[model samples]
Target: MIACNFSFHYTSFKCEKNFGVFLAVITIDLTSISVTSAVISMAGKVMKKESLSIEGKQGEQVSLLIQNQIKKLLSLFENEPIQIKAVGVSVPGICYSKTGLVWAPNIPGWDNYPLLQDISYLLRGKNIRIKIDNNRTCCILGEHWQGAAKETKNAVYLAVGSGIGAGILIDGKILHGFNDAVGAIGWFAVDRTYKDAYSEKGCLESLASGKGIITRVKESLNIIDDYSGYFKDIKIQNLVIGDVFDAYKQKDPIAQKIIRESVELWGITAANIISAFNPEILIFGGGVFGPGIFFIDEIKSEAKKWAQPLSIDKVKFSPSQLGNNAGLFGAGHLALGRF
Candidate 1:
């Protein structure tokens, strides 16, 4: 069996087995409102897992809740030590695992936090070791570990979730910039029109993040809610990208327009990336990608119109094969330095 945890700075995974029974792969996602945890056990080559999600307030309080959740997970396996080998973590921002320093955005009070030290302290003298990396890098590694890029040595993983980021792997190596911010593609400005409003920085995320999508929709329709569909039947605040996709599938004009605009922006951004990286494949993962994938072909078509023709032709675009498990999987891989 395998279990993993993700937080502001670290991601940890544990694998256990008892003769004929192996633990299943477990995945957890820690966001502002929700903290999801899972446990999986394996029998033979088949795997079975159970997962739970808890919604609560965001901010510092949420972090504490996550810590508690981790403690609970550890308690469950406290009596068994041989079943757990190592732990891995994936953070949202720049992470220097060697030093255990993490600088994250969404989670306040996490800047330059000594996450690995804290986790290690929490575990006391346990025989478990922890591994950590930036979420984007983890995403890329995760994809390579068990996702879309497994067969390709060179590929890029784009995470379009609450915020935008990328994980680049060239020649089978994850690129780490001087400050470990190599994949911080959210700040990349692709449109000059938003320069002034966005403070002269036109990060692709500013125009394409989940929040960006909602903001754009609001500005275009004067709607305050996130939903867009049969107006009276669906509330905007309750509308997520999935709901938007369903609306688009049902031929909702507003959903169609919003999706078209978002797709164009993504296409332009992807083209720029392809021109710069020229990877063998581009894997799209994260929460937004679930619905954004509906526009994959369209995005590629539009990317070709803007990107270097040769680069676009060289790269293939696809959805994440790991789905939500990319980070956890990458966490394990990072801890083991397997790839």
Candidate 2:
């Protein structure tokens, strides 16, 4: 048997089977759903159960891949007698709440695309309601929903990836500014002097992001007389995050200098987030932080310099427990409309 309750929070359908009740939730992460990738998963009451991926060039092929995977999940749930309570989707770019349109910079042809309508079209006869939001917001919400920030009303997730972004939760509500772009912290001005490149992705992001670290290293090497020590055999143009980390581990002077700057930038960014939101916990995640987790203590120590005296000491700084799955679970929480 199934019982459903409709409210502003979520339209939850409770499925009572012979042994227990199971609520099925579907979460789709479209961050990599471009000319090269996509990932979707299904979750029950506790954790993610299954997931699928798509890797190919962008075009009609990508659309078909998404639709086919969704259909398959729907069918799988239907056969298991599982009740899909809600569907939550996390987009890589800006998500217009009112119109369900998306503008993803990395995924071509998605500028203001009517993504919700397209998904709704696929479930024309179903009662499931879909909710969509940016991946940054999803990351924080995921933490609040089931990870580190659980039970906390105020928190922030500092996502340091190729670029920097943040997910803020204030007073138990996800903060979505007028343009639904509140967490685009990459553009935050943390530096006094600006350059042309800084204008492209913001001063903070251009200086502290993973790619930024690589760029700084490359530029530093070009101006110096030598790449002494472990950096001697490095290639600038092809430098990647792993290579930079390797160099850092080997105590390469250039890598050390660049990474030290990045750490300070991260700490400054954290201080800003702390001063603004006064969250209970400041969670760190994203690709850069995966290997860069070693710097958490230093980041915390640095944040103490600029953060609000009253709030800085009150908050906790920690790495994400959910890791890459933070956004996925956050999407599930969105579908359930639960804080």
Give the RMSD in angstroms, all C-alphas superposed, for model 1. 5.2
Per residue, candidate 2 scores C-alpha lDDT tens digits across 215-267 of 88888887888557666676567677878888889888888888888899899
Reference-based TM-score of each model: 0.80, 0.87
Worst 10 residues of 1 by lDDT: 40-49
**Backbone Cα, N, C clashes tallied per candidate:** 16, 2
lDDT of 1 at 334: 63
Runs in model 2 with CA error above 4 Å? 1-21, 33-56, 59-61, 222-225, 228-238
Encode model 1's per-residue lDDT on 223-316: one tens digit a residue: 5456544544766576566766676688777767877788888898899889999999999988999877777999999999998888898899
